[model samples]
Target: MYAVFKRELFSLLNSLMAYITIGVFLLALGLLLWFFPDTSILDYGYAELTGFFSLAPFLFMFLIPAITMRSFAEERREGTYILLATRPLTDWQIILAKYLACLVLVLFSLIPTLIYYYSISELGLPKGNIDTGAVIGSYIGLLLLGSAFTAVGVFASSVTKNQVIAFAISVFICFIVYTGFDAMSQIFALQYLESLLIGLSVNEHYQSISRGVLDTRDLVYFISFVALFLGLTRFVIGGRKW
Candidate 1:
């Protein structure tokens, strides 16, 4: 697992793909937060980074799938998955290594965004008037959300040999898991069922956590969501295809 993790991380860093992915992520966020008209932070006339947190999950919907689409898809396409499976490593370990690799890249992409927080702090009328606790909570929420997306992407890749198909399927799955539950709740006629459905959505838990409260249930839900996909990836990789 460690060897695979190192190799995957090395491959991501050694190529221009890593730079491009991070660059695009940062650029899109930057433009929306600071440059674009109407939606720009400057126009909003507020020192808080509420806009960033609000838009990040949507941006991640595309960016994360791009990063993980090749996790297993490329290996299978290039016949490296056979070589990888020949090693003594278990299927879950392999899935985890790739998942962590993509997660590291996601974290790296997020690091630069701290500048947004700092900038907002300084721009405030009282200087450093930002909601530090909420900001921290939102960051944690974003990480949890990103981890779930990464796992889903890994599972999508594990089930297919085509990166494009992997990406599309991941985006669709991520979209559904992220928002489908809430949509279902709205459609359901029973209030009790609606409440249950809402609780199942990632956005529901994420928003709850983003309010500077660390609920164990929210954390557990996120972890279980990630684990579910990783487990599915392992099951898929354990098949004859490997």
Candidate 2:
């Protein structure tokens, strides 16, 4: 598992596409947080990272899929998965290695944004007046959200041999998981089921955590979401005879 993890992570690091994707993700966020009129923090006159936190998840819906689209898809398409099957690794180990590597790339994209936090903190009216607690909680929520998306992406990749198809599937699933539930909850016909629908939505839990409250229920939901998708990936891979 460790060896597989290293190989996958190193491969991503060596790939120019991975770096370009991360670069574009960061660059977009920077532009939104600083230059965009409607969403810019400076224009809003607030000492918060609301712009970043709000825009990030939408960007992630696309960014994560791009990162994971080639994971198992490339291997399967190139006939390298047959070689991988000859290894001593178990299905779960292989799936997890790819998942962890994608997640590390997500982490790399996020870590650089901390500079925004510091810049915002210093730019506050009274200096360092930003809501530290809420920012921390939001970061926590963001990381968990990224993890769940990575699992979904990996599952999408495992189901197809084409990276483009994998990316599309992952993005569609991510979109539905992120906001479709909330939209469903708002349906007049589903009013009775609103609470249940909202409970299943990723945005609901994410918004709750964004307020700086650490709720175990929200944390559990994110963890379970990741596990469920990863289990699905394992099931798919295991079903393949090769």
Candidate that scores best on lDDT = 2
Q: In model 2, which residue pairs have backbone atoms overlapping below 3 Å? A: none
Pairs clashing in candidate 1? none
For model 1, give the 10-residue run with minimal summed lDDT.
Answer: 183-192
For candidate 2, give the lDDT of residue 78: 97
Tell me the lDDT of model 2 at 163. 95
Q: Which stretches of candidate 1 lie over 4 Å from their true place?
A: 188-192
Residue 215 lDDT in candidate 2: 95
Expressed as tens digits, the lDDT of each residue in 163-240 for candidate 2 is: 999999999999999999999998999999999999999999999999999899999999999999999998899999
lDDT of 1 by residue, 70-155 (tens): 88999999999899998998887888899999999899889999999999999998999889999999999999999999999999
**Which 10-residue window of candidate 2 scores lowest in summed lDDT?**
233-242
